[model samples]
Target: MAQKTVLFKHLEQPEIHRLDVYRDAGGYGALRTAVNDLAPAEVTQMVKDSGLRGRGGAGFPTGMKWSFLPKEYDTSYLVCNADESEPGAFKDRELMERNPHQLIEGCLLAAYAIRARHAFIYVRGEYLAIKELLDAAIEQARQAGLVGERIFGKDWGCEVSVYRGAGAYICGEESAMLDSLEGFRGFPRLRPPFPAVRGLYGKPTVVNNVETLANVPHIVANGAEWFKSTGTEKSPGTKICSISGPVNRPGNYELEMGTPFRYLLEDCAGGMAGGKSLKAYIPGGASAPMLPGDCQDVGIDFESYPAAGSTMGSASFILFPEDCCIVFAQLRISEFFSHESCGKCTPCREGSRWLRQMVERIEEGGGREEDLPILLDVTDNMVGKCFCALGDFATSNIVASIRHFRHEYEQHIRERRCPFRPHPAAEPLLQIAGVA
Candidate 1:
């Protein structure tokens, strides 16, 4: 595996986040080098060359996103979508809290590359303290002429402002973020005018994920080839793998993309909590479909993950031990998606609730074999019938589960009982369990 880039670099340093400490550790030096030496186009080209995609859920290419901007437009903007509300995804939060300047530096470099005169970091409301830290970092950068006015004594100049979102998951979508930033409602707009050409304030804009922007400084500091040396040939660079659920050491593991799941679980995260045998895994957060234990050997990269039948969405690796009930865990995840759905689309808004209800019924030993087809029918109705990706995302687990674990679902329906009922956490529900 290639070097762990952002997370491991200044991790051990007690004062790594401090302005003086970060500066000494070759932190914002990349920004200085970028502004002084590289042209904006060259920087964008370099990022493209490096094969950096959006660290956000959607794996859109970063430079391609920047290149989508209309060249003749006068007032293009860049906004870092820090409104990370994905279930089981917390990499952005760690980056914001522990390494604000790294993100800030990336934002500045992206702003310069896009020729954005103004930029905004749209942070979620829950990250209040992190926002303050980022603001302070921005101020520090501004005072040093890294932000605001003619930065680094160059003809090009830009300013960055941090805006807080009103705790909406939908705002994580780029267009919705732009809307929220403009002090409007947070519903997703129709996307023919994708954020690249027509974005914030009806001008060209580029919105990037927090972790995606955080990669910029290092990519610029080291050449694109250096960044490409790590990870898979297609998906380069180290990604922060958030390994949670039943793992003994459930935390972020920033490793190269093609790192083995066993290495990530055993060596990096100290294996499962009780040395239990591994069950299924939701490779990239709850949104991505579950992978059976047999596929554990698959490399954790864009190409490999999809080849194993899942997308690399935000690198939120959630593992389940062999003893854990897939039905219960899936039901819980469905409930979460049902709760978080923005209700913009009918399929997601209503279908998620229905799906959760069915799962709940099955979990409580109150389902029938007939319900299996019904569940599939319900899931079938949701596919490609929602407003945003969130709708489809909400249904991915149920679809994948039935495809792989139909017997488990059938066991719930056939005997009106969960085959693996050793959990004992369902006493309350079983007390009132009845089939509908």
Candidate 2:
């Protein structure tokens, strides 16, 4: 199957966002089944048996994560990480916009599984309209006795709240989102007293990505084995792969986990756009390392990516064409990491800025043969040194671009200008003159 539209199947329906249409199409059946029939422990076991991993960067087992909660908890939270702030990751925003009910139902089922009394969909503030849609859907679920007051006449009663964040990339981190949900500055908390033990409002919590939670309803409605039959054994369930940049059809496509990137680019994405040959592609989001054009057969799974020296972070694949400058692309990405840096850790705060400056210098024809080792050294200092993954993320494209396209950077330095762009950046050229 080229594109398996599980969550996206009903997106074409104009009114599918509405509860009535959603229910008519068998929506909330999972939540109903989960609440009325399965016990919380049973629901958790089913998820564990399904082998569903987080669709976000971490790829942790969803069921095992749910099982982390304290045995006896008075109150807990379930957070849906809808802050789709990664550069190439736009699947979550559309997933919430088009299929709000399914998301709501999934949240409800997750809440039931974890015994969370409250579930919050922490959305990106840029998505004002989608936030309204989720708010309305939550209200709809509430009115139907699906959200509150002994859901399905059982002892479990959970409600969902839509909390819009100010579009901080750091807030996409679970702990940072929890801090934001508690009305604090969006900074990640120190671990050990992890979220499952003391999370939102200082209670146990489970944070999952929009795509990860969206799959829960299907898993619960159909058995775990049914869900497992579709994707790879290691990475069970489908992934909503977001392919952007220079592709004919650069949009989200729900695909089997182990499908190769070649199929996605040639068939699903309608091949490269404007007759440009594929020079490279970042298999995951900007955080994932960019792969060479020749490595197109890389499978889109948790194991396949790491085996190929990259990752499936958010399953956001950003394609690059021959005409595109790898250094320039990495410069733009580094600048983003620098701009979005929360400054909580010195490594990321200083290293990201320095990394951006180095890449910018290389692109503007000020790079040295020695700058290569210096750039690598700087990234070496920053990796695994940040408060969160931001610093580590800042180095992915830079290191990968250097590794795969060292000749390109060398060409820029040797020719004293970017090969792709004939006209050179003038400011750096002017700096040599000292003619202020």
For model 2, residues 1-436, the per-residue Cα lDDT tens digits are 4568788988678789888999998898888887778899999999999999998888999999999998998998899999988878889988988899888888888888888888999998898999988888888888988887798888879878899999788999889999999999999788879999999999999999999898988899889999999878899878899888767887889888888889999999999877878888887787899999989888888999999999999988887777777787777788788988888899999999999898889899998898899999999999998768888999988889999999999998898788888423222211221100
RMSD, every candidate, angstroms: 3.8, 4.7
Candidate 1: residue 180 Cα off by (Å):
2.0
Cand. 2 TM to true fold: 0.95
Top lDDT: which candidate number? 2
Global CA lDDT computed for model 1: 0.82
Deviating ranges (above 4 Å) for candidate 1: 419-436
Q: For residues 154-258, write the lDDT of model 1, one tens digit per residue.
A: 888888899999887788877778888888988777878787878899988899998899999998988899989888888888888877766667777788889
Query: What is the lDDT for 368 in model 1?
Result: 79
